[model samples]
Target: MWYLGSWMFPVISAAMWLGMLLGMFIYWEAIGHPIYPSMDRGQTIAYISDVGAYKLKPLFIAGACVTTVFLDLGFLAERWLRHAGRLAPNTSRAQKVLSVIAILFAIAGSAGLILLSNFDTYHYPRLHDAFLLLFIGGYWFSAIFLCAEYQRLGIHYRSHHILRLSFWVKLTFIIVEFVLAVVFASTSYTGKPNVAAVFEWVVALVFTFYVLSFLLDLLPSVRTSHHQPQGWALKAEMEKAHHGGQQPGAPLTNDSAGPNQNRHVAPGDDLEAGAYRGTSMTNGPGYPAEHNDLGRQKRRGIGRLWS
Candidate 1:
């Protein structure tokens, strides 16, 4: 059977998140935008949580939980693809650390979303607010870390414009969400519940775009029958260049040797009798007693090197 690329993860996540918010708004509006039990008299503008707390409790909780689960999965998939060389590898220790940190933050944000959805504002008001803060703050910090990581990745891999694009998308998300979140908080605290509710809805709407931005990051890793991902192609080119334009595991030969001969041994070439698949020159016993003249150790191959 045919399969779609991992990009579907973020697409489904964004769709579900947007659908949940839209469903709540439309349903509430259809019911004449009644003042929810949690609201004061004359307050006709219900927060997303307020609407979800009453009639659409099940839909809100399920949608938020499912959307965030897939969102976290998307973040995890990107990191895995990067390490597996299907996407651009992290070129520095800092990049690797930042990627992991970003994933952690995404997971934390997902947890907050799930918790806040379950803890309706009508009941656990304080806990709901706290988890909402966590949900927003977690994603904001995640975007910041991703922007830093992608900036470094883009610097090292200038040809991949997708990195730059993803960086800017996330940076824009951070800026927009930060501003809206601050305003939402200020309005909520200053007795302007209607204004806060409007900003809250806007914030959720803007967050859908943030969810969609992962598409830019994951698109390069997509593969199909007639197509290869740019990430895979670039990785292949780098590997080919590193191995002197010769196919990996091919017998290295010198001018004096036959075409198929493996007589030529470079400084760090695996010398374990043509075992080139897994044996590393420095990490394993690939270096036999006869090849002691080659004193230097190359990196533990591209995986560890890039990682």
Candidate 2:
């Protein structure tokens, strides 16, 4: 049995989520005052207004409800597959697609909030609201999906490329969104509502915190990579081979030379040697054929590092 409790990941995840929600609530309500007054009273009136009378409530509520139902259905289906042992307890392409959709919905929700804040008479048909509501609901559902995927990928395949890619992608997107929010708040139309401005700032702050939390969670993995055991014997042997051909008091080998001695030398040793094998040989005073080869090999190794 894959006991999720065996690891502290769940506890860490719960703590992170709780912290984010609490921080967002505090900033939105008390600190940032993102919710605006129902009607513009003047330049001096604060935008704190009751949630019930807010014109955006219908759109928000409808979007939230429909998205929630769709997400629930998806969750149940996934659970069914898992329980029947038909799905692996790891991130699959399906999960990635679902996560992308969830991210889209979250972005849409944010957009809706921004739009509502800007336009006082923003009204749409119930059908349009339904679509928005569905996306809103999907946001939470997608969050759940992400949690599960993290557990499966982060814990089961700690160093997997998919896990790394997902983490970086999410982090990058969050950072970009935060930057966009700042830009939006700063450059919005003059008549934009105050509530919307506050909301954008609050969300930006929330995303900043989320990014920090993710970095914290990823710290251990980063440390493990840096400190992981490597084959010292192999590294030592390579170094030994590199220095083996050095002659005492001889000038250091030329920057170009076939390291493996497998290439034919041209006149003046200027013929490009070891072209395909990443080794190069060039003749010059103080340039050892060995060093030239090693240098070429080293250059090749550096290229591989970039790739």
Q: Can you give the TM-score per candidate against the true fold?
A: 0.78, 0.27
| lDDT, residue 53, model 2 | 26
Number of the predicted model whose TM-score against the real structure is largest: 1
Tens-digit lDDT string for candidate 2 (101-192): 65555455445533432332333334343543343343434455455555555555454344455555555555555455555445333565
Which window of ten consecutive residues has the lowest lDDT sum in model 1? 298-307
Clashes of each: 0, 20
* Per-candidate RMSD, Å: 11.7, 19.0
Residue-wise C-alpha lDDT for candidate 1, range 105-128, written one tens digit per residue: 988888899999899898999999
> Against the true structure, candidate 1 has what lDDT?
0.84
Model 2 stretches astray by more than 4 angstroms: 1-91, 121-139, 158-208, 211-307
Against the reference, the lDDT scores of all candidates come to 0.84, 0.42
